[model samples]
Target: MVVERKEEGKEQLIQRPVYYISEALIESKQRYPHYQKLVYAVLRAQRRLAPYFHEHPIKVVASTPLANIIRNRDATGRIDKWAVELGVHNITYESRHAIKSQALADFLADWEEAQQPSSQADLRHWTLHFDGSKNLEGAGAGVVLTSPKGDVVRYVLQLRFEPCTNNMAEYEALLHGMRIAKEMGATRLRCLGDSDLVASQTSGTCDATDANMIAYKRAVDQAGASFAGHIVE
Candidate 1:
């Protein structure tokens, strides 16, 4: 497994190689199903890079429907065990495409192997942007959800509950946006928000000390776990 840090360049995004891990498969293991091997690779990488996986959302770029296979309701035995083990981390999968970086390309050249193409249903990736504000007038929130097909849905809400803080409103917006996206059948979602605190709290990078904040973070985690792939940024 290889990890790269993405940086915006003058005209394009640059992928800087950061970490790499490799394991040789035994004879019996090498004969496992293609999807199982992919999942095992991911699990091995996560085990070795627990800190990175815990702090940031890791995107697994592959040509297969790894997320669907692992998250399937009918998954059993070892697959179910892999799902449970991987459920604790924030992970998302994207379709593999052209590699622009020479270093990355070289690193992945030998690792590339043909796999079954992902289905259209498994290729759907949604983008969600949410914001919340508290002013003397009142507290309200807004969310914008964009489908994979470029369709957009906008939502606005006014918080009627008393004693709402800006942070609370931020959590409310994020939670509300996630709920709406799930209802709309979004399984792979990328969440964007202006509140650094909210994002950090939800991603488990920052500690939520307040009771309300802790409760809100818990709710967000639960809501996020329902999706096959999701990231909060």
Candidate 2:
């Protein structure tokens, strides 16, 4: 979705950026065709032309039931997150009965077939390894997810915050690692980490007594629940 200007009954394009779906986004179990398009449109527009959106009014012309899908009662997880992010923009959606402009027609045609990579789908169990380390310099975390076909994804996250405890850093690492695994369509996950307390709490083996720990525990649980099978050690 690009910002357009109407001049003398002509719709002029402002900014157009091509958005390609990453492997992580393509494999996300929670993504649907419609949801993916809507999210991409809103997020791409926001990222590229945020200042313009803040200063001007924008109208989204679409024939699809985009409003209904985002506002659906069953919407949760990433869909909910995207909707909340889009709420800040002053935009309205109107159904266009016809495509009067040639530019809009072309744009729609290109966007329609954007993210369909191929027909083959991969189904395999994935292993996720995460660890959080803190030292005098700083605190950071790393995670690696290895698929059955040997496609390994390694993510290194540096945690920057003053007055942060070691346990808090461990929880943050687990939360981020689980999110990556979920996005990559890991239905069956074997989670490995050195933080025994964090892993045990997330797996429901140990109780979370601290307020911060309780909140982190809930976040990890929600992320893991999307998977069919999940084990932490």
Candidate 3:
């Protein structure tokens, strides 16, 4: 596949694709007893996701609605307390997932359009992005797909990389985004990446595929299965 510096997707890269773990909002109950139960439940999930959370390092962002719990109450304490019971050390993590763009609905619509089979309607296009961050280092990936206007989109995830290479990170960002978009029912997709290796691997233009790329390749292939048309740029 010839590499071209083209922007064919519907959404321009006002911001490049970034795939990094972000904070999640944990709703709490007003009743103290129920609140304890909810806190413990969240802690259980935290424990299951702990290793990834620690390595990828996304800060756990949680909140108790002020109406349910008083501001004076140690909300963070709830997590900390249960974490202790669950054997999670109070460690550093990223806390930004709780904040996401309001464009999720719009983005999902575009993904659905690209996912339909080539039968009646014209093939459509959409763009997906991923950014992976660790400390001062980071990488980004992007893809475009179309899906139904009302469907919720999902993607694959890469938990961690020990030494962390930029190229792999870049590729994973794209793979991860593709997985989610496909899961969300995207039909047609154009995978995008700033990294030549990532684009090449997906486009079959690069023979430099490595062992680490196997899983990502599978996700990309599977994501593309739903799409009647797809591309990479």
TM-score of each: 0.51, 0.46, 0.37
The global Cα lDDT (0 to 1) of model 3 is 0.49
The ten-residue window of minimal lDDT in model 2 covers 19-28
Candidate 1 TM-score over all chains jointly? 0.51
C-alpha lDDT of residue 233 in model 2: 73
Q: Write the per-residue lDDT of candidate 2 for residues 5-70, one digit (tens) a residue.
A: 555655654444332222122223334577566655665466446676687777766788767766
Candidate 3 per-residue lDDT over residues 72-173, each given as its tens digit: 345565544444544434433233446444344345556566545565433455556454433444333333444434333444344455666676677667
Order the candidates by lDDT, highest first: 1, 2, 3
- The C-alpha stretches of model 3 lying farther than 4 A from their native spots are 1-122, 133-159
lDDT value, residue 99 of candidate 3: 41
Model 1 spans with C-alpha error above 4 angstroms: 1-118
- Model 2 TM: 0.46
Models ranked on TM-score: 1, 2, 3
Ten consecutive residues with minimal summed lDDT in candidate 3? Answer: 18-27
- The positional error of residue 144 in candidate 3, measured at the CA in angstroms, is 9.0
